[model samples]
Target: MAKAKNDSLFSLIKSLTQTEKRHFRLYVKRSGNTQDVKFIKLFDAMDGMKNYDDKEILKKVPSIKKIQLSNQKAHLYRQILSSLRQYHISQNIDIQLRENLDHAKVLYNKGFYKQALKMLDKTKVLARDTKHFTIALEVMEFEKQIESQYITRSIENRAEILTNEVLDTTDIIKSSHQLSNLTLNLYSLFLKKGYAKNPQEFEEVNTYFQSHLPKVNFDNLTFYEQLYYYQAHVWFNKIVQNFPNVYKHSLAWVKLFQSNPEMIIKQPVHYIKGYRNLLGSLFQLQYYSKFCEVLAEVEALSQDKKVIQNLNTEVLVFQFLYISKINKHFMEGSFDEGVEIIPELTAKLEKYQYKIDPERVLMMYYKIASLYFGSGNYRKAIFYLNQIIFYQDVKLREDIHCFARILNLIAHFEDGQDYHLEYQIKSTFQFIGKMNQQQAVQKEIINFLRITGKITPDQLRDEFIKLYNRLQPLSEDIYERRPFFYLDILSYLESKIKSIPVKLVVQEKFDGLK
Candidate 1:
């Protein structure tokens, strides 16, 4: 029985395209279901529903008995899957390979050993070419079965050949798996700790990566194994804040796919991830020209129906496009341009809210807040930062959460909310302490903001200058620069002292970069 919270069937139905739904309806009708079919009626009712309510479904689809609703929903769900399978048989490589394997089995049962072996050979080639090792192994097993049962002239020394092939393929698959596991661990370390803020954290991640990294001959590795190797290196560099190495390895990862375009077609998800990491490295390096070139290529690939047909890939397309698009503005300090796209970006964020990860959603909120802050709209910035500060979830990205609170405090101060400035400072200080994020930059910001209200207006400029001088060196400190990466406190203070907008100060800095 489906639980009240488990509306997976309804969610799946809601995710279907109009073409898929129409195909499903035609599939049912072609199978001799009448116009008043129970499942069809239920499908129509559920399709039109704004939410999944079992009582509402039963009320609308009177043909379904109350006692049998669960069974009928389950049946419809399986039927939809069946229809999708048939529809995608020609388009999906895994499905086609499996279907071919099933046909080979039929031939074997009908005493056609030669035909079955031939089919297995062809299917094994497809599976191996696509790096579908498990299917390839299964096809090899089928071949071994036929070789034992009946030996044909073409099957001479076939057992020896199959034995060697299986051994080599298994070794490659194991190596790939190990590298992939290392990559995942490195990524987890990155997500939890975020760029190794301290020397100890850096040493920990570096030790783990170096110890677990497989010492394989890169020249002899298969494409998939090599891909994972480069990916592992990319994550290692990213975690240690080695942007140059990140660019080198991530560019290699992207080029591997570009050189093997067929793999891009077969593994669009990996291809998308490669581009994402590449763009991230390029953005960090501020290589705007190359970034724009790659961004355009990704946008073009995303529009190709063949590249983004799967639901997960569809959501990934949006994720990569929006993140890279907004990041371009961030890199150039084009806050006004970033603000212009917030409406569309927010709508897409809400539309794909379920499909996107919460971490990404939170990051977007931070980016939006930063955009507002850069444009001097401190109230709007605080509004978005509050979304992150008040997020009531256990799995929130702790780094973003901590930084959002810091940015919120700065925004309140910049907005001149003097009435509650002391209280905000106290709350932010306590929150940072609770999170155990009392680093040099965090402590300095808290100390400065905590006493802002006590200083008279005549002494405000001197205090701002004093705090700026104290923080300028810390902002340049290799280990203390992480918070400033998110919020440019020095520029804000300089703007306050110079009696100019922070935007102008940021623009002047950006021009110096050019």
Candidate 2:
């Protein structure tokens, strides 16, 4: 029985496109019952629902009893999957390979050994062509089983050639296995402790990565093996704040596909992921020229039918494209102009709300709020910040939540809402205390904001300079640098001391980097 969660049948139905739903209707109707079939009625009820409500489903589909709902839902789930598989067999190589293998199995079972061997050979060639080594190995194993048991001897010394082929394939699979494991663990480390917070953390990550990294000859690796190798290096460098190595490896990852354009079509996700990492590394390095170069490619990808045809790829391309676009604004310090993207970003967020994760939504809100705040649009900034500040699941990205509160306090203070300022500052302090997010940076900002009201107008410039000087050293302190990435308070302080917009100060710095 299909378990009844909000996700089970309801999510699958919601995930279907109009075309898929239409195909499903025709698929189910072929049974001759049309919409009256039990599962078909259930699917229709679920599809029409805005939310998953099993009780409401019973009301709409009166023919289905509570006792049989689970079984019927399970049947519909399998039927939908089968229909999709049949619909997309041409696009999905794995499905095609597996179907061919199944045909070979039927031939083998019917005692047509020579025919089965011929089919297996063709399927193996297709699998290898697609870099589906695991499937190729399975085909080889089936071939071995038939040749050993049936004595077909279809080709001379076939056993020797077959053994060597399987051995070579296994070696390549092992390289992929090792490199993928390293990459996954490195990513997991980043998720647990973002960007090695201190020297000790950096050393720990470096040691762990070096210990696990396999020593493989780059010239000898298969494409997937090389891709994972570069990915692992990119993750390790990113976590340790080694932007130069990140740029190198992520570029290699991108070029790996550029040199093998066919792989780009087969592995669109990895291709886009390479570009994503490349853009990130370039952004961190403030390599504006390179970032723009890659951003153009990303724009092209957003329009490429081959890249965005699959639903998953479309979601990823949508996300990576917008993120790159927003970062371009950030790099130029054109936050006022950046706000122009808010409507489109907001609509896209709503479009993929269920498909996107909470962490992604939280970051988008933070980035939007940061843009508004930087542009001197305090009320709009606070509006977006409140999205992250009051996000129900604070535990999801606590750092974003913490930083959102800090920015909210600044936004309120800047907006001249002194009536609300004291309360918000108090709230922020308590929130930080609870989250244990206190660093020199946070403490300095809190104390400065707490006392800003008492400073006389003439003394404010000196105080701003004092705050900037005090916080400037912390930016070089690896442990204390984190808060800056979220808020860039030092730049804001410099803008205040100079009586200029934050964007000018940031743009000057960006120009220096170039």
lDDT of 2 by residue, 1-514 (tens): 1333346678788889898999988887787867568888898888888877778999999999999998999999999999999887877799999999999999999999999999999999999988899999999999999988988979999999999999999998888998999999998777645777667888899899999888899898888899999999999998888889999999999999999998888889999999999998888777899899999989988889887767788888888788888888888998988999899999988778767877878888888888998889999999999988878977676778888999999899889998999899999999888877787888998899889888888998998899999999999886788887788898899899989999999999888977
Worst 10 residues of 2 by lDDT: 1-10
Model 2 C-alpha RMSD vs. true structure (Å) is: 3.0
Residue 232 in model 2: lDDT: 97
- lDDT digits (tens) for residues 189-215 of candidate 1: 777767778898888888999999988
TM-score of each: 0.94, 0.91
Total colliding residue pairs, candidate 1: 0
lDDT of 2: 0.88
Candidate 2 vs. true structure, TM-score: 0.91
Residue 185 of candidate 1: its Cα lDDT? Answer: 89
Cα-based lDDT at residue 301, candidate 2: 88
